[model samples]
Target: MPDWKTTYAHFLDTAKTAYTANEQRGDLLVQGELALAKVTVDVASNDITNIEREEELTLYFQMKQLLNILRAIYNDQFDMQPEKEDALVAAVLYFVSPFDAIPDDAPLGLFDDAQVIDFVHEQLASDIDRFHHEM
Candidate 1:
């Protein structure tokens, strides 16, 4: 397997590039958010009951939590520095991009997305804590 940390780092850069594109970034993120929603629904409908791995469950939860946090930021329910905000947006946008470190169609495809979210959460731990506390 490839180095997830490095791969996720590249994802952040890609996401930042897209986010810096203004209106197009908004459209891309919307598409990503919708894709995440669809995946959430699919998991709830079938795979939720079948998921037996602890790691998988943890990743899924992180994906949901970070996405929620990202939504709060976008909705103005939370605040973050522009750089961190851009990173957060980039992490979320990974959901819509098919050409990522790991193909979204492969087994455990979302592993990369979840890891990126976790890394962002760690890097912005205080900001996330503030978001939780302020909300």
Candidate 2:
């Protein structure tokens, strides 16, 4: 796998994967983006050094861009499946909470995202019962 920069660039460059993934559920794109956003937040909250301002700033910018992409994907996907929109939104919010296995101020900033993404992917792939349960 390439570095995070390359991987990030690749993901930012296209919507094809999301489009294809959403064909069945029609909301996979939004769910994916929501999942990404939640994961990004998890990563961001784990900054350990107050002195490494540059790194934090870079991450913040990346987070902003990722958030925009997620909003777009979510909005588009949400329009297609209004029935489960509420549930999807709830799940995204659930993951966005300031709670994770690691403290937000840990040295490994992006660690939480990996775990969160795995969970999000699982949830998004499964039924809506879990989402509704959160409500």
RMSD values, in order shown: 3.1, 13.0
lDDT of 1 by residue, 4-27 (tens): 666666767776675664465557
lDDT of 1 at 114: 67
Report RMSD for candidate 1.
3.1
Worst-scoring 10-residue span by lDDT in model 1: 46-55
- Steric overlap count per candidate: 0, 1
Residue 10 CA displacement from its true place in model 1, Å: 2.7
List runs of model 1 lying over 4 Å from the truth.
21-25, 45-57
Every candidate's lDDT: 0.67, 0.40
Flag clash pairs in model 1: none
Q: TM-score for model 2?
A: 0.30
Residue 71 in candidate 1, Cα distance off native in Å = 3.3
Give the number of the best model, judged by TM-score.
1
